[model samples]
Target: MQSFRTEIENPVVERDIIELEKKISLFRTGQIDEEKFRSLRLARGIYGQRQPGVQMIRIKLPYGKVTSEQLHRICKVSDEYSTGRLHITTRQDIQIHYVSLDRTPALWAELDKDDVTIREACGNTVRNITASETAGVDPREPFDVTPYADAAFRYMLRNPVGQEMGRKFKISFSSSEEDTALSYLHDLGFIAQIREENGTKVRGFKVLLGGGLGSQPRHADVVYEFLPTDQLIPFIEAVVRVFDRHGERAKRMKARMKFLISGIGLEAFMQLVEEEKTALPFKTYPIDHETYEKAQTLPNPPSVEVAEPTDESYLKWRKTNVFPQKQPGFYTLGIRVPLGDFRTDVARKLADLVKTYANNEIRFTLRQNIIIRDVKESLIAFFYQELKKLNMAAFGYNTTGDITACPGTDTCNLGIASSTGAAVVLEELIANEYPQYLYNSDLTIKISGCMNACGQHNMASIGFQGMSIKAGKLVLPALQVLLGGATLGGGQGIFADKVIKIPSKRGPEALRALLDDYEEHAQAEEAFHEYYQRLGQMYFYELLKPLSSTDNLAPYDFVDWGNEEEYVKAIGVGECAGVVIDLVATLLLEAEEKLSLAQESLAEKKWSDGIYHTYAAMVNAAKAILTSESINTNSYASIISSFDEHLVSSGKVSLGSTLSDIVYQIKTNEPTEAFAQNYLEDARRVFSGINAFREKEVNA
Candidate 1:
């Protein structure tokens, strides 16, 4: 790889890029294990695509906020390293595809120049911190969550406590009681709230814990009705610590925080979080929101004589795609990018438009669309004309006609069928046949390549999950139709029900049946989920079962969407959460690395960070030894106990105290400098003892 080390201004980021280059070199020369290298690259936002030798880089944009200059930088990187096309993800990040793995370091260096990042965009860390795109401007919001979200993202970006865990942790901040950010579906969700206390107003949040959507979805439990704003980051840190200690590791499917909390019960999980509070560095980490509250210097509205178009299409677009901000005389314009895919040429033009006319800021929505904020009311006509020139002024920004779908079989290894292909057909059907639904916000449609729900299929009113069905002697692509899902606001939601399965080619037909049935049904002015509940799941199943027939299958039905050949069921190992390799030598090496980090933190006088790093090092050493014994070490807590039972009790290794008492000290004592120093020494001793024992065994 060509050197671009001097391009990065931040020394820490510079080292990170250089380290990635070194690791890639090591992996290429067979010095680094593939699984270990996979984890390393994933933390930097390099993800494996279905196609080999090329990668998809996810550029992390906290709360979906992107400056025009940053967008231009992203487009430049896309053009230089990969295809000049960008895909906005449901998590509010941008992914560019088909780039050589060798160029990732340079790509990252380029993005960092504009203060953009891809760190923790993937892997078992805190993923992108998302919030309502209308956060600052939403009239219903008590306070803007942009500052709080940015603070959380900065704090957790490279925190040692969340560096590696059994599974990824997702966090969201909703703008208001409407819960537009979908707080209920996250691992740790905060809904902005405020209440009066003795004639003084104070900001806080309604906290939700442990919700997830997949093959089996769970609703998050309300842990607190109102947690003070200052305690938000501290509370989040405690929860992450507890999860890292107790979360499942052996069972990949059950490794999510939702499963762990459900297995242990929410009450017990809260107790664990409470227990970890003392180890936290802050009792109340106050965020500086005054800076964010400061008024931005927006562009002056240029005087123009052009009149607003009187066409029905423009009128409908105005009603649906334009929203008024809390700041009077300003509007936010939503641009519907179908399937979250757009060309770089259009992106550059959009960036220029926003920089010149709007607030120079654009936010990618959770529904995989873009919104330009703080546009003057007078410039609406001018902006619309400019956007129309770029072919980006399409109607139905986030309505029934705007379907959200993942890049299923097109790029994902776990994809069973072509979700993007199916989405195109369904969207076209809605545009041509169901134009009346364009203004309807009561129903939603989402599709995923598989049960993983990356496209958020389970949370939509009408959802489809990719699958396959065997008919007679042949296999064909299929979709699992889901219904009755909706968000009820205030941190509450319902996951869609799996109504029936049908051939992939019939996805559009199935949607047509559902919409047609709803249009002709008895109820007046009923929402889609409510209509489904009124009739029940069995009714929809029976209604769509006719389309599930495989008896009269055509030759085209055997082929998946967007394909010309016969369908083949080929599934690759997914790297969504990064793989875990239990190689004994690798684990020991990881233990040594953790000890070095612990020492570094102690030297820097970060007491709490040092103590946590020490705890991790001790646990890693224990897990390393237990892996050699072939014992089940599913969680860090289990690793501690199993180490005691299998090795410590057997007199094979000797620590001054039991491993639990030493490791669990983190939960008991405060993270004082004295404790941090003692903890680091303990970790070093434990790792040295384990290393000596392993060396003796190797020598024998």
Candidate 2:
């Protein structure tokens, strides 16, 4: 286990891995609290699966971009440390399941050699930064969002402000006004734009804030019509700072930024962001777009004689899966990864093919598919022939027939039913019976194992959420049918409305009913959502309500899709957003750890980072004392007030001024070296006072 430690080259990453190894040792020995250990492991992208003693590791790929070498490295790690299968997520991350918990540090070390990472992939941190797959290659894009997304990912990867937050935060970038990245559903969404002022073309973004989807979906509000490129990072930093300070902590479901904004109002939230600007290190952080402006190294021509495909299937694949790039004579080939699961053997061959005939780069799509860029126009047939052999050349790249689904009962602990299983049956039903829908781009179908919406089912034209229903004394798997959701470009969208619930066995029947009704009554050239809106949600409910009956059920109705055995409801506790129980001792230990990090940042001359670390240390110490008092607190803002009221007013722990006065200095003062040093010293004194009081009280 220790052998791979020495192989890591980056000192920061090596230290992170070593700390993980140490924490794992502590956890094994029962020295660390299970809840705290879960939080730690999750930040490293090691997620607990439904099955015990195994983990599902999420490999974070910023903006879904992966080079051939990186793909090769991921394949190697999956084969060595996990099952050979890779599951692509809607966020464009690749997950490998059934991995041993002890081998994760070594696995991470191996991936680091190829500049790949898993950190912050599945936790209450800044999750993977995603963008449109066609960012650089899209013909309508004003300028590529790749560099900006990369900058945000890099700036927030190990940033202290987001290391531990109320809940996970998501960010996305759209290539154009098309909003292909689904920016309306993200916490922070940016749509690329360019404006000409005084004969100078200034690149900027139309920024949206506080958007999210789950049980309650909220469309993002426009925060900025035009925010210059230079201010992107600073604005993000300010917002995260505000969220960390005032966002909910105790209520797991309400901890999202969307809820915070909804509760406090956007005007109040922006005021907090404005107050944080004084402490920001950069007022205008410039991104290096020139670095990404360089041309990609194109592949050489194919050497072997490959026959051109003239079959009907080939023509359909060409029409559906091939896209013309902005670069002349170059095309992008789309591979529809069903349920986003592909084996390492297929991955290795795809990697080789990209290196041989494309730009040696691939971007996993938000729809959980793969896009190969810079393929020469003449080589499209060759690529298709090669992909067909791998069983990855299916048509309907992003059409109605191409369904998006999460790994439900297959791997997710929180799964209520088999989403991937049901998805397979539905896709087969569409291909066999409703083949015309394959060419329809106006409709989408997405399925989630549960209402958590990991499959993004709530945002599709047609959606299904896995659920359970009772018939007399027996229980059966069911799906909550949703309809009328669609994304309108330029930061506008609508969440699907739940229409009805039907047995899992009758999902195909429900889909058929919806499609048939739309075809029968819809006006010419009307979209699915428009047709549904024209009729109304209750109208579709009545049409499919017949399939909801359980009285005529057969024996197969008792079983979930893709399963041979009878259904047994085994929903496990999810670790994605664990509710942390703070023990006083544990909180103090964390406070000390933060102090150490603050010292390290100060030594490295990172004033802003050091200041944030110092601020967190003070808050941790206060929360520890409050926990000892049985005074439960939620937000960090509450912790400060509670500490001041309970301890300071009672004269139990004395400081020169109010707790708020000292802590709010982070917002009032500039993050200069002198202020950072002073803040660290103040944190040390505050922690010492609290520790002394706690020890004395315990002794007494």
Candidate 3:
């Protein structure tokens, strides 16, 4: 096996790589030309993930569909550039990882040849436009959203207005009620709907805006109950313009569309949207109706007709995993990709199977599962047989839901523990002890190796975050249990409240106990999040109190949560580096030249030393910003501006300031350290000013 260090030394000499690296070096030197920087960043796979080192490269598949040829291209990229795995994110985007600094541009060109792109996939610009994977094929859907999604994508792909925003923008479309598109969590979520008036079916969409997840999670608000599909592009453009002009830019965390909607009440926001829409050029162009029709026409699936009388094993698999499509004699089988991961071999085999038993149609679900739609009822048995052969036939849907986990300590630099490992254990426990739970209830058990919430733990009914605690003298793994998060019905989804912090070793048992409690106490037919909501915080606090012992926790305390049992697992040891400012500085510098100042100051140091220095700089910067602020009306921007001025004047960047600046500057102009410190000083200030603003109406 070749070492990563060796691979780094033996750089791939692709054309894009040379140009991309030059631009990256230029950006690092603070000599960034915005246009060039954008081009390079997009050209390369450098995306701003919730964490450092880890870059979320969005591989664009026009109309949310990919061919086996495209799939192979992606697989090659995954194996060559990333972790030999691909992640199908909720936004209908394929995210590859462990990408090197130099190989990105080459990867982009490789994808470009296949008509896929990563342009504007990240940055404070329009991200990959997403549509329902089953857009045209799902018969229950009112209309194929593929065209609409494509139109929106084309319109926004390089729109001058989308060049820079207060924060990154996400858009998604759901053609039906399956809600697989995760419309509620996007910055702008659109669901295709139809209205029949005077015996005419008018195409329209229910538009949602300002919903997202991170440290603060909020569900999008419906700005328009219904707007004609033809008007969607303009409507979306209007919303983008509104967000661009008025969205909070000084405070990165508070700059998301959700915060904007929360600040001005949703109704007022809607009124603003309506006002914007009226002023905008509402034009409809010629859509490729032929292409859309072709997409809608189900390709004849390969003939592998099975005899009647389904095998019992296949029947059980179908009963547990297959979802009935509105199409007669057709189904969408869920192939559980546990921990939202799969080997490249498995991916290749699955792609082959799709070409064979299915109609060469495969849909990747946000749950990290794959749906092979257009599978004829007769071929179900053969499909299961092939799936079992490939070791991809796990009947783990909705029971343990395959444990929606991020590539935690194994691959992410920001992860606190082995999230994937935790997920595997959790899924195993549920599968072995309470197999009935898989069928009887709809439970979402999500885990993030860290608090960045990449795993969407904050939105799960029962969420867990990996951390460490000091068990007297030794450090031990621990997990934070978050209760009452859900995203079921398109409203602002509530974040799970942290009720208990227990050892990672005890996570499975603790979860089982919690599930048992839920089963015992929940009202008949109540959903997990709903039942937890009715139970309230007190009941959960008391129920999990016994698991909160710190006897076997870690000793290192990176975050001051005031709990000796809770510590941030040190960075560098995890799969992905932890959120160390030095690492972020290096990445920022490598991505663009302007970040060279911070990079030069902190480069070539040991990870621990670099982190400590970064932390101190951030603290000093925050203090400077806060001290400079006018007590009465100091906005986030004012503090950040003050901090930047201080950094320039003093020629010193503190650890806290570095961390805070990166985080805060991403949204607002506020100094990151000041914002964080302010949150600590007055929890309500953080809540009312940002948290509550983002999550004002979410059911807690």
Q: Which 10 consecutive positions of candidate 3 have the poorest summed lDDT?
A: 574-583
Highest lDDT, which number? Answer: 2
Candidates 1 and 3 compared: the better one by lDDT is 1
List, residue by residue over 56-112, the lDDT tens digit for candidate 2: 999999999999999999999999998789999999999999999899999999999
Rank the models by lDDT, top first: 2, 1, 3
RMSD, one per candidate, in order: 1.2, 1.1, 13.1
lDDT of 3 by residue, 486-542 (tens): 766543456789888887767777888888998788888888888888879899888
lDDT of 1 by residue, 20-68 (tens): 8988998999877898888888888999999988898999999999999
Give TM-scores for every candidate, taking all chains together and pairing residue i with residue i.
0.99, 0.99, 0.73
Candidate 1 residue spans exceeding 4 A from truth: 295-298
